[model samples]
Target: MRRRNVLRACLILLAASQLPSPAQAEQIIRMSTTYTTADSGLLAYLLPMFEKRTGAEVKVVITGTGKALELAKHGEVDVSLTHARPAEDKLVAEGYGVKRHDVMYNDFILVGPANDPAGIKGGKDVIAAMKKIIAGKARFVSRGDNSGTDLIEKAYWKQIGDRPQAPAYISAGAGMGEALTMAADKEAYALTDRATFAAYKAKTGLVVAVEGDPKMFNPYGIIAVNPAKYPGVNYKGATQLIDWITSDEGQRAIAAFRVAGQQVFFPSAKVGR
Candidate 1:
């Protein structure tokens, strides 16, 4: 009987060892997002709460909106959050994404050195401001990475039918934060989302050079990659994050987030998808 009891205990231990470990069983979802969302400290502020509530971990890949959507297109990520609306619609229309949910919004602003070499400070017209920069041949830093901000900047130049010449137009080919730092370092003008500008305001010493332009309105959206296209993706986990982020609680949290003692992103979740 003693031998039998010992054998039984050993069997129990072997069975336990065969079971999956806690970490291995834990749910995880991969997300690709814009640099602005990450740099503005929004993800850092909200992701922890999500992990605690759902017992799931979110692996984030930070990149420009264009690249973020590209990752989703390849099914490399379970979800994507980006600021380019037209691109987001295209992704869904092409059936790469399940659906798009309105996440939040913030306006883009033109920022430059305090001295305002372009003489565009306090202007509400972005095109007018760009014209001033071109007229003065003021150094203008550009992300030049085909990012959403870059697209907008290029569009403004297209609208004006002019751009700063090569020497004056510095294509940093970097992210928003880095472009802003480059702008500051070069005492140049650059267009940026307000949230990132707010976060880097003190560090960059770049003041808002132009704002309040209706054309500068920027909106963000979140979409889960289609599981049909990528069977390996964690669709259930992605849906959980999507539903949670658009829920009332999540919208409230977004609304409450602030930088430099001022709210930067405003919640715009319609709350159903």
Candidate 2:
């Protein structure tokens, strides 16, 4: 009986040795995405589906698109999902990102108080609307956080050759949601992604003042951090995520995410970045 017990114990030890350790047994994909995606609860809605299909857990770090790309540049995250086409292209050109795949998009809108202090309501031209807002010295809230929206706002100011130095022009130095909230609280105008704006519109009581401009189009792209640069990064998992997100199932999931019965983000996997 003693000999039989010893053999059973040895067999169990061998079986355990054959099994992978905890770290090897499970995969974790680190991702950095824009605050809009996270705040709109899209990630919350879609991550579970991916996890269910792939059995790999996702660790998310939410910030602006600029910061998300920065995380990818440092190999701090295995992948990034962000909008900001210029910045995304730069990262890929600089060799930090392996490839960029078109994911989804939502246009930016000028949202402000229903009173329309800037007289930009229903404006078809964003440049003209911004000029009106500046001329009237209407209150405007800027994200001022080197975010994608901030970059676009700065470009608008540059186009008009005027910076908002007036006291009415406030810099929130925060994300889209916070900037929109600040705008709502102060009754100031702000540019925000449609998805986030829709999510917060009722709560903030802000209305879309300007939209449908060609330049208002916002496109999101997904990039897998180059594994060659950082071998420690989960390249395999990142690829899996990117492929799955661009697949039919992923596009369908994106289309399915809606805020208040209104579809905010549109699927762009079929389109090019």
Candidate 3:
């Protein structure tokens, strides 16, 4: 009887080995995302849940939106999460992106010293606030790395037709977190994503000087790298991730994320499916 039991166990083990392993089999999906996403704590909260649900590992590469899109264009990543709409559209137009899906949105805010040297506090119009900053020559720190925030800042500058003069305009060539930090240290003004700014708010001591302008709206999108361009790209994993993130579950998770109990990112994607 004992021999028969042992034989049965061996047969069961053999059958289990023959069956397909986990669907992902611990496959790793390479993902690129903007620094704002990483610094805002969204990625940290969502990735682990996604990994647990899919049985797949995600390798995240954090950088500016331009760099993230470039990595996806080269197929160095399976998907990219970024906020630069024009550049993201260009990626798809150029055939490097398989598809783009709206992920989430927040708004850009002008953060400056508590003293309000530019006197932009309580302003509802972003353009007017920018004009005030430039006119006042208030010290301003710029994330000059061509990030999504930087692009928006440049557009505002173009609208006013004058760049912040030297000594007043300090280009940090860094991420949102660093730009905020520099702005705090220099007691300058900066344009930053609300989520990232909130995350670093306690440390930076910068106040939201201006907001509520429609032009300050910031949207994020996720793009799956084109498998046709790079045959080795993990298209399956990318699709799964995109589908999951756009699903009801993922949208709720994003909405639930907060900083200091204040919801930072609002779910903007179409729910379901």
Question: What lDDT does candidate 2 reach at residue 114?
Answer: 96
Candidate 3 structure quality by residue, lDDT tens digits, 1-273: 999999999999999999746564427789999899988898999999898998888899998888899899998999999999999999999999988999899999988999999899999899898899888989999999988888889988998899889999999999999999999999999999999998999998989999899999999999999989998888989999999888898999999999878899999898864
- Clash list (residue pairs), candidate 2: none
Each model's lDDT: 0.92, 0.90, 0.91
Alpha-carbon runs more than 4 Å astray in model 2: 1-26, 271-273
For residue 162, give model 3's deviation from the true position in Å: 0.7
Cα TM-score per model: 0.90, 0.89, 0.90
The whole-model C-alpha lDDT of candidate 1 against the native structure comes to: 0.92
Error of 1 at 233 (Å): 1.1
Clashes of 3: 0
- What TM-score would candidate 3 get against the native? 0.90
